[model samples]
Structures are given as C-alpha cells and as structure tokens.
Target: MRVETIFEMTSPYRDSFRIKGFRFGNGEKTLAIAGPMRGDEIQQQYICSQIVRRLTMAEQHGRISEGKSILVIPSCNPFSMNVSRRFWAMDNTDINRMFPGYSQGETTQRIAAAIFSALEGFEYGIQLASYYVPGDFVPHVRMITTGYETLDTAKLFGMKFVSLCKPRPFDTALLNYNWQIWNTKAFSVYAGCTSRIDSTAASETVDAIMRMMQAAKILTKTVTLSPAYEPAVVDESELLHVKASHAGIFYRLKSPGSSIESGDVLAQIIDPYNGQCLSEVKSPADGIVFFAHNQPLVFENGLIFMIRGM
Candidate 1:
C-alpha cells in the first residue's frame, strides 16, 4: 500500500497541512473511495480512513488475494476541518457544488477540480457523506441518474434503503457530477448529520464499504450485512417537509425514525416572552419522522421537520 499526501493550499494554522490518502494493490480494477469534502464531516472521513487502514493491514499480511486497486481520500478540506466548518476557508463556498473543477476559478472550484483530477479513472467510486442538515437520517445510497447498472450496485453495499436522484444545477456536487462525467460507477452513502457524529451511522457506512469489497471479490471471507429495508427506494420528492405553525421556543414531541400518524404532536412552540403555549406542530401525514431541526427556537415560517411515507 502506497500513501500520498496532497495539499490544496498551505494553511496558516499549520504550514502545508496535507490531505492524506492511500493507494493500495497493483491491480487493474480500481476503486476510489472519498469522504467528506466538507471539513465538519469528520465522522465520514474517520470511517473512510478506518476502511483504508483495514485494507492496508490485510494486504500487508497477504490476506487480500483479489486483483483490485483501491484509493481512499479521508478528508478534502483541511481548513474547514481545523475549525469544524463545512465550507472552504478563502470563501464560505461549498466545495461539493463545484465539479470537474477549475484551476483558474474560485478557491472551491480549484480544490474541487484538483480532487476530481486526482480521483480520475476508478472503476468504482463510493462517496461517503454526512447530512449537514437536521435529523438522524437512515443509512442509504443515492444514485446520480437512473437506468445505470450502478443502481444495482446498491445491493452490494448492504444498505436497506437507496435514494434515486438526478442532480440539479445547484446540485452540481463534485462527486455526483464527477461520476456523471467520468462515467465512473458511483453512489453517495449518507449516514448521519453533518454537525454531529453518530457512531451507529459510522459503523453502518464501514460495513457498507466492506460489502462492496466483498462483492468485488477483494475479500475471501463472506461479508455479513443487515437486511435491506422493506421499501428499498425513497424518491427525493416524496420527502414530506413539516414546518412550524408559529414563532416560539419549540419542545420536540418525538425523536426521528419514530412512526407517526396524521395529527400526531410533533412539537410544541411556546412563546418565549410569556409562559404560553403558542402552537403545536403536528404530523402532516402518516409516515416516519426523517429529520428534525436542532434549533428549538422557531419562527412563523421556520421548517420544523420532515417525514417520509413508510
């Protein structure tokens, strides 16, 4: 296993803080696995590094006999990683939105392009992600477009649910867009929230990577995986959004992943100025609470939570 250190730019905090990655196995079939482009996404990066360490150890001991190459980039943005922010340092630009990258463009575009160039020509790609928004999202794989054999690859990940999606212009996210251009077979494995770390989500993501390696015949032993979810696919449009009815301090009535019926009390917004119950946010439909905001203080037009039909 050969490891490489690439730097997007020199950081002021630490001189030439490098981005760490590993290239393993001298085989024809290549697998590129990348973690969060956002610095705050530490969990995703940690899990990817774990995968690399395990694979490297196995290869060192001659345990892995399969003829396949693997590349693991644990973290992409060191500046953001330092401050635990989600965007780049030069500007608060989201690197995911910039694709196939630009050398002469903005800071984010330059870095995004550099990462893409470094990751070119992989037979399979797995982009590990942490949900930046609220709620403990169920582990799932998201495909960029439809009717590609890549959708079938979800089975190998051992994830219960998969979300089929097409990226919009705003969604020109680096990984998704790069996958489209490179024709690299890829998917986004989203495990937990961005601002927080969830150990369960991290384990699930690591297991998913192992499943993929097993399918590739990289590991000789059988890989055990959890059963697929009953409803294997969730459409992006079907994610029902629930909003606050009035401005107040909210008291959450339920946790995410709990089944809900229409009119179920989702939260209670209380007037902060006075000890008065301002309003109650109820479930809009019979479904599972997929996401909830951390900010208990709510405004009249604030989005409270989201539920997806079971």
Candidate 2:
C-alpha cells in the first residue's frame, strides 16, 4: 500500500491541507473510491475507512489481481470535518457542486478540479455518498441516467437496490455526472444515514464493493455475499413522496426499510410548546420505505418519507 498526496494547499493559519490517496497493487488504474466531500458525512467517511482497511488486507494477502490498481480517498474536505461544518470551512461552498472545476475559480472549485483530475482514467469509480436532507436511506447504489451510464456496471456492486435518478439541472456539475462525461463509469453508494454511522449498513456496503471487485477481476480471491440479495432496480417514478402538513417536532412511527400499507400512520407532528398533535403523516401507497427523515424538527411540506410503491 502506497500513500500519495493528490492535492495540497498551503494554509497560513494552520497546517497545509492535503488530499491523499491510498493505492493498492501496481500497474494500470482500475478503480477509484472517493469519500465525503462535505464535513458532516461521518457515515460516508467511516464507510470509506472500512474500504481502505478491506483493501489493505486484500493487498497484504496478495488477493488483489495482478496488473490492477485501486485508489481510495477517504475524505475530500478534512478541514470542514475538523471544524464540524458541512461545506467549505472558508467560504461555506460545497466542494461537490464544483466539479470538472476551473483551476482559476474559487478555492472550492480549485479543490474539485484537483481531485477530479486525479480520479480520471479509472475503469470504475465509487463514491461514498449521502442524502441532502438529514435522514436514513435504505443502503443502495445510485446511478445517474447519463447517456454513458450502464446499469450492468452498477449491478456489479450487488447491493439490495439500484436507484436510477435522472440528473437535475445542477447535476451537470456533480462528480458522478462529470465522471461519466469524461468516459469513466461511476457509481455512488449510500449507506443508510449521513451524519451517523450504521454498522450493519457499512458492513453491507463494504461487502458489496469487495464482491464487485472480485467479480470484475480486480481481486483474485473469492468474495461471498452475506444473506444473498437480488437487487431491485428502482427509478424515481416508482417513488411516493410523503410530506409533513405542519411544522413542529417530528415523531416518526416508521423508518427506512419499513414496509407500510396505504393510510399507514408514518409520523405525527407535535406542537413544540403545547405538546399537542399538529398533524399525522400517512402513507399513500403500499410500499417499502426507501428514505425517512430522522431529524427532530419538521417544517410544513418537509419531506418525511419516500416509499417505493409495490
């Protein structure tokens, strides 16, 4: 295992900031796994750490395939992580939103450019990603419907679900979208939650990546998937959005992975001062919950749950 600096910037206030990459095996570039670009993605960073550990043991045991190279960048924005901020510590900009970035642009853009440049030329790319809202996700592999995306490559991870998302207007600047445009097949893996770590989800995520590596000939050793999974390919149209009717304290009766029928009481909003039930949020369709808000407070029209309809 070799550790190399991918990008670095001198900081007058403190130590220099550096984005480092861990390399496994030697020869052609094969796979690149990136971790959190924002500071609050503790779960994302933790998953990437586990991936590094897995790769380390694989390399030490000579399980890594010959003439194959894999790189893992555990965290992209360490400064924000250290300070407990989500975006860039300096200007509060998101590193993720600035991709295939201009070197002469803002600080975050420069960082994005540097990181993206290093990730190019890989056969496959995996990002430990998180949702925008504070919530729990049913661990899955997410793929953008870019013209270059191939579902066959995404299924190699062997996760329980493959979410096919159509890129929004701003998605053009995201790393996953840019990677495909640059001729690199890319995937984003979400492991249940964002700020908090979920061990079961993390383990499942690691196992899936290893299984993919083995199947793709990046590893020579056999990898067995636990409990077995026949992943469901789900797109946005199959999802049912459940929102809160009033703003107040959120009391959830269901979580991600829960199965619910139509009219099921998913959650209730309580008046913050009076402790009175403001409104009850119910499921509109019979389906499995794909995502659920876990935060304490909810605003009117806030997303409470996303169910994949049966």
Candidate 3:
C-alpha cells in the first residue's frame, strides 16, 4: 500500500501536473487502471477518481484484504484535464494516440512512457474511456483484438454489450501499444461522450468496474449486477450512416436512447425560408436511435443518426 506522485514537464504552456498513483493491499495479482488520456473526456477522470477515493477509504478502514495490489492513475494527462481539452498543449496531439511512449519523442509520448513503465508486470490493465468524439451516450467495452479470451474478458464487465474493436497494431494507441509491450491482460470501458456527463453512463461504468473487482477477488462483497439489458449490438459492419440528403433546418421526431423501427420518420429537414419540407429521413433498421442531431440547422451530408439493429 503506497502512493506516489510523479511530476515532470508535460506541456509548454504550463508545468506538468502531478500524476497520482495509489497502490492498495499486498496481493500478488496486481491491477493497473488509467483514465482520460484525452483532455476532452474529463468525466472519465472523475470516474476514476471516485474509484480511487472508495479504495482509499476501504484501505484506511481496514476493508482491503491480503494478496492483491491495485494501482490507479486517476487522471493520466493533467495538463489537458486542467484546460478541459483533449490534447497536450505543446504539440496538440492526442495522448492516447501515443503509446509505449518514448523518452525523447513528444510531450504526450513522454507521459505515456512514464505510465507504461509503471504498468509493467501487472495482472490486468483497465483503460477508462468515454466517447470523446461527436457521438451519443452509449456505454460500451472494447478490446484491441479478437479471440474468445478477450471477448469473454470484455463480457465480464457486465455492460449491455462488448464491442469487438481492433486498434491498428502499430498505431501507437496507448492501450493497444502498451498492451502489446506489456502483454498483460487488458480491456477498456467507454461511456458517454466528450464534455458531457451522462449519469446513466457513469453509473454503468461504476457497475462495470465493481464487477471486474469482484471477478479479480479484490473486493469480497458479493456483487449482483442488474441482468444485462438487451442492446442493439451492431458490429462495425452493421453500422448504417444516416447522412442528411438536403441542407435545411433539421427536426428530430425521435430522441436518442429510444427504440425505432424501419421506415419510422426519424427526422425532417425543412427549408428555413419556406415551411415546405425539403427532405425526410427514415429509419432503415429496427434498432435503437443514437446521436440524433437536435439542431434545427443542418448541412448537406451531416450525420443525423446511427441505428444499431437489434
């Protein structure tokens, strides 16, 4: 049980903020958890911090057990966290994009190097994440590769579904790159989107983390997760891009987080000057609606919704 703070130059605008790591218990199976490498996904950092706070309380109250060590880096990139941005100010690069970081590379690369070096020989690494891009609040778990092992591991998180996503092998993504080098068991939990705090997504993420802790025997309390809610699990192959056909004022007839059927009137694009409808977008599949553009004005070829079939 130890706590360490690493301080170094992270960006040009300001000195590096402290990267805090907490080790709990004295178990042989060590776990490393990280969150919010991107500045935009600051909510994820908050989520990790909550977990650390709980674990710290448990340790102080003599609730933690023997033979298990857990290391949590609440916020990996503090510079971005301070400004609520997603990239380091120095090079404007996504920190998660720099993995297996180099000592002489870039700012983000150096932070990754320090974190990855600390993660060596851990039993499992869980990368915390949220949809930092323009997307809907969909809580999901992802793995870097396929095979039943990783799939099962993702499923154990007790989320609605696990997405089988593959990162480019040599892309230097923090999770994928570090996984390759350390070769320790790893998975990532993604919830909500950038700059928005979806309470449902946050709760689901907390539930997933508790489930993992129970599976690892780090926490003795028996956890009963809600029966998995059936979700529209669509592969990257099944994703239908609903693009706006005409430029006009867009009105969504339906909201995200709701089920829709094929041919349903999802939205209508109308001419601003005239009351006449310019174009109507209909659902092509029976699935859940996500990422509905609520704005009245829309551009041609703008993404309206992403429907994942049931």
Candidate 4:
C-alpha cells in the first residue's frame, strides 16, 4: 500500500489542505474509488475508508491482480468535513459540481481539476455518492445514461438496484458524468444513509465493491460473500416523488425499502406550532420506498419521499 498526496493547497488561516490517495498494486490503472466531496457525507467517507483498509489487506496478501492497480481516495473536502459543513467552507460551492474543472477558475474548480488530474485515465471509477437531499436511499448503484456508461459493468457491484439516470443540466458538472465522458466506466454507489453511518449498509457496500473487483479480474482472490440478489434495473423516470404540501415538521411512517400500496400513509407533516397534522403524505403507487426524507423540518413542496413503482 502506497499513500500519496494527490492534491494539496496552502491555506492562509489553517493547515494546508490535502487530498490523500491510497494506491494498491502496481500496473494498469484499473480502478479508482473516491469518497465524499462534501462534508456531510459521513457514510460515503466511511465506506471509502473501509475499501482502503480492505484493499490494503488485499495488497499485502498478494490478492490484487498482478497487472492491475487500484486507488482509493477516502475524502476530498476535509476542510468542510472538519466543521460539518456540506459544501466548500470558503464559498459554499460544491466540489462535485466543478468536475473536469478549470485550473484557473474558483477554488472548488481548481480543487476539482487537481483531483481529476490524478483520477483520470482509469478503466473504472467508483464514487461513494450521496443524494443531494437529506434522506436515506435504498442501497443502489447509479449511472448516468451518457451512452458511455456500461450497465453490465455497473451490475458487477451486486447492488440490489441499478439505476440509470438521464443526465440533467447540472449533471454535466458532476464527477461521475465527467468520468464517463472521459471514457472511464463510472458508477455511483449509494449506501443507504449520507450524513450518518449505517454499518450494515456500509458493509454491504464494501462487499459490493469487492464483488465488482473480483468480477472484473482486478482482484485475484475470491470474495466469500455472494450478492444477495440480482439487481433490478430501473430508469430514473420510474421514481415517484412525494412532495410536502405544507411547511411543517416532518415525520416518516415508512423507511427506505418499505413496501407500500397506493394511498398508504408514508409520512405526516405536523404543524409545529399547534401540533395538528397539517398533511398526511400518502404513497401514490404500489411500490417500494426508494428514499425518505430524514430531516425534521420541511418546506412546502419539499420532496418527502421517493417511491419505486412495482
């Protein structure tokens, strides 16, 4: 295992910021696994750390393929992570939204450029990603439908769901999208929770990555844990969004992975002042809950739940 500072910048008010990467084996840049680009992605960071630890052991045991290399970057924005902020601390910009960035642009752009310079040219890229909204997701592997994306390769992760998303306007700036455009097979793995760690989901995520490596012949050793089930392929368009109709304190009656029927009460928006039920958020379709808002307070029209129709 070799550790290196992949990107660094001197800070005026604090210690220099550095993005560290752990490299295993020595040959083709076969895989690159990156972690949180934002501060609040605790689960993403934790999953990446586990990957690095496991890869380190694999490297010592001569398990990594002889001619294939793997790089694991556990965190990209430690400054924000230190203070528990979500975005870049200096300007509140998202590092993830500055991919394939300009070196001469803003701080996040420069940071993105430096990170991308070290991460590019790999055969496969995996990001421990989180949803933009504060919520819990059903563990899944997501890919942008950029034509360059390989769904079969993504399914090698052995996640329960493989989601193919149509690229939105803002998605062009994301790391996964840029990696695909750069000819790397990129996948985003969401491991249930974001700001908090879920050990079971994290373990599942680590196993999924190991499964992928074994399937790709990047790891010569066998993984004892097999995939629980074949992943269900779903398009992004198939997800149903349940929105809050009134601003209030939100309480969820169903969690991610819960089966639901049409008109089932998924959650309730309570009037914070009067304690009255402002609205009962109901499921619009017979399906499974893909995501449920985890935070307490919600605004009018806020996304309360995401259901995957059966």
Global lDDT of each candidate:
0.74, 0.90, 0.71, 0.92
For candidate 2, lDDT tens digit of each residue in 1-310?
Answer: 9999999999879789999999999988899998999999998999899889988988889999999999999999899999999999888899998999889998999999999988999999999887777889899999888989878878888888999999999888899999988888899998898888889888888888888898799999685566547788999767888889999999999988888999999998999999999988989999999999999999899988999999
Clashes of 3: 5
Cα shift from native, residue 264, model 4 (Å): 1.9
The worst-scoring run of ten residues by lDDT in candidate 1 lies at 222-231
Which candidate's lDDT is highest?
4
Cα error of candidate 4 at position 256, Å: 0.8
Each candidate structure's TM-score, on Cα atoms with residue i matched to residue i, is 0.88, 0.97, 0.85, 0.97
**What TM-score should be assigned to candidate 2?**
0.97
Q: Rank the candidates by TM-score, best first.
A: 2, 4, 1, 3
Would you list the clashing residue pairs of candidate 2? none
**Looking at candidate 3, what is the lDDT of residue 69?**
83
lDDT of 3 by residue, 52-89 (tens): 87777767766565777888887788777677666776
Model 3, position 41: C-alpha lDDT score: 75
Model 2 residue runs over 4 Å out of place are none
Better of 2 and 3 by lDDT: 2
Clashing pairs in 1: 101-113, 131-194, 160-229
Each candidate's root-mean-square deviation in Å? 2.5, 1.2, 3.1, 1.2
Report the C-alpha lDDT of model 1 over 133-247, residue by residue, as the tens digit.
Answer: 5545666787766345376677677776777766666665656666756768877887755556677777777878777777767665664565434436777677898888788
Candidate 3 residues lying further than 4 Å off, grouped into runs, are 10-15, 60-65, 146-149, 169-172, 223-234, 248-256, 270-277, 290-298
